[model samples]
Target: MSHAFDLALCALILGAAVLAVTGRNVFGAIVFYVVYGVLLALAWLILGAVDVALAEAAIGAGVTGVLLIGAWQGLADAGGLEDEAPRPVFLRLAAVAGAGALGGLIALAVISLPGGDGLTLAVVDNQDRLELGNPVNAVLLGFRAYDTLLETLVLTAALAAVWSLTRTRVWGGVPGPGHVTRPDGVMASFGRLLPPAGLLVAVYLVWVGADAPGGAFQAGTVLAAVWILIVLSGLQDEPRLNSLPLRLMIIAGPAVFLGAGLAGAAAGAVMGYPDGHAKSVILVIEYALTLSIAATLALLIAGPARRAP
Candidate 1:
């Protein structure tokens, strides 16, 4: 039964991917891409990686879908969404051939690989050192803290790149355009109703991350979605990019993380925590990361400044 279910799931995922790649309409492609992400998340769950499933669903499907739709809307507003000339037949054929070759290579690699819990046992044996109940969190926040810190910085850098595209006249202004809707509309009603629940879920995800399959990325994505919804429904406008408090929130995570890493010199490593305080330090970093990640993601989807302050 499980095998049959897996086959069906794989079919659905493949179908979605094909539609997303080949669909002519921009909106249709985005919808199929989101479906692909959700199906991929289910595949991760089937592999027993609940944390990965959550991250994939929240970030890959939810957040990315929003980002793509936002971009679509922007293009429409700017008159850039009109249908364009189709590619040449030769060019189309070359793209399909190249994609097929890459897919074949990946399949060969996966089939040739020998699997035996590559580092699972090693991580389990040393999990006690980090004092984290979640092995994935232990690896991310402890064993490979530097990589995680860099990941946060990458998001910040991406945001900076997006902001750099803003017109000079709109510098220091609000990201994205102003949004307004009827107060009694469905969107506005959802804006009012959903945020409280989203806030609770985001908090719960972060708090339980220490011992369970939840974490900063998932929680932050949810929070960002809530904020995006509020903005879209016209309940609130995006804050100006030049706001000091907003800038501080954006840097809070990386600043706190870097400070903690520097303090780790006392423990003989750059990101090490002092004796008996690993969990405390990790929690602090996670909370700070949650705040920065939420703010960064929300701003990212809001896009570059488009209005004067």
Candidate 2:
């Protein structure tokens, strides 16, 4: 029965992927893409990767869906979605061939992976030393802290790249399209009710991540969505790039993570915790990271600044 269920899910996922890629309308394609991400998240859950599933559902599907929809709207407003010349048939065929070959190579690599206890055994062996109940969290924030640090830096750099695309006149201006919603509208009312609940959930996710499936990234994504909702409903304005507090919030994650690493260095090893203080330090870093990640991701979806400071 489990094998049959898995087969059914795989079929659904593949079907969604096809619809996303081949849909005629851009809006339909984006919707289908979001559905595909949700299906992929379900696959992760079935594979017993709850953390991965949560991230995929929130960031990959939810946040990315908003970003793409916003981008599509922008392009439509700018008349950039007008019909364009079609690519040559030969070019299209060549592209498909290349993609197929790459996919085949990836499948081959997955099939070739060595069968054994693998990294799971190693993670379990050292999990007790880190004092983190969640091995995934331990690997991300403890064992492989440097890699995670670099990942945060990469997100910051991507935001910078998005900002660089702003027009010269709007450089360092307000981010996003600055949408305004009707005061009595459903969106505004929902926005008012949602943030408080969302904030509570985000905090809980970050706090519980120390021992559970939630984490900074998932919490951050939830917070970002709340901020986006508020801005879209016109309850608040998007912050200018030069806003001091906004800048601090955006950098808080990487800043705190780097600081923690340096603090660890004081104990003779970089990114290491002093004896008996591992959980405390990890919690602090996660909280700070949650704030920064939330800010950075919200701004990323908001796109480059459009209004002057």
Candidate 3:
């Protein structure tokens, strides 16, 4: 809150970012990357964008950190973590020069930007139309529902692409490898203990999103993390790629969202909600999306199928 604190936070953020980008150790880079994401989330909180902060903390830091660690594990398992080509001095210099130039340009652009409430007042003025107290929610699910729909579809498409990489022999198989741990081990213990809390938190985030800073993406990320933990800890295994229930959970969100858009078009404008029903519609979409996003994100991180169902 104070200038000193802000300065300290900024320094830490920059330091973490630098370490993430330049660290010689892959694991250390990943740890710093996660720290960088957390610091950025804190910066967002200081700027009063609680929604963005929540998103950054959950998706940006938490889920992404897990994903990176997974990739590292995979690489290590495959012997892909072996020594690589040495960095060329010229390339390093060029990268430094390019990054400096880009940073300078960004600074200049920000300094030149006009000071005004770009769309804040307009969004606020029409906020009541969506019947949502959270302006971010209103803007995302109401004013720009089409964009949100596209985002969900994109995520689904990404998961599809990941699945497409599976070998034909393992097409319908479970993703990633099996995990084995002692029943009383720490991982197994936490896997059993943490999921209940994560589920509660995820549900609360979705429920509070209507009037608060939480939403489908944040909840989905938490749900995905829980699922990942369960799998990694040997409490459960990743679902088969061709499982009917698994597929349904992956498609339910986008399917519902598109259906809502079609229903809106039949009644009137595409993606438009009927009078007095916007919040209900949005909530329905959010809940459906939460499930699909959780499934998709978890699968994406798990990578392609590796074993028979």
Candidate 3 collision pairs: none
Runs in model 3 lying further than 4 Å from the true structure: 97-114
Tens-digit lDDT string for candidate 3 (184-256): 9999999999999999999999989989899999999989989989998998888878889989999999999
**By how many angstroms RMSD does model 2 differ from the true structure?**
1.7
TM-score for all models, in order of appearance: 0.93, 0.94, 0.94
lDDT string, candidate 2, 1-309, tens digits:
999999999999999998987677788889999999999999999999999999999999998998899889988999877873456789978987998999999999988888885688999998888788999999999999999999999999989898889888877788876778889999899989999999999999999898899999999999998998899888998988978898889889999999989988987999998778888988999999999999999999888988876
| Candidates 1 and 2 compared by lDDT, better number | 1
lDDT (Cα) of model 3: 0.92
lDDT of each: 0.92, 0.90, 0.92
- Give the alpha carbon lDDT tens digit for every residue of 1-309 in model 1: 999999999999999999998888889999999999999999999999999999999999998998899889878989887864566889989999999999999999987777987778999998887788999999889888999999999999999999999999999999876889999999899999999999999999988998899988999999998999999999999999999999999999999999999999766888988778899889989999999999999999988998897
Model 1 whole-model lDDT (C-alpha atoms):
0.92
lDDT of 2 at 79: 86
- Candidate 1 residue 68 Cα shift, in angstroms, is 1.0
Per-model RMSD to reference = 1.9, 1.7, 1.8
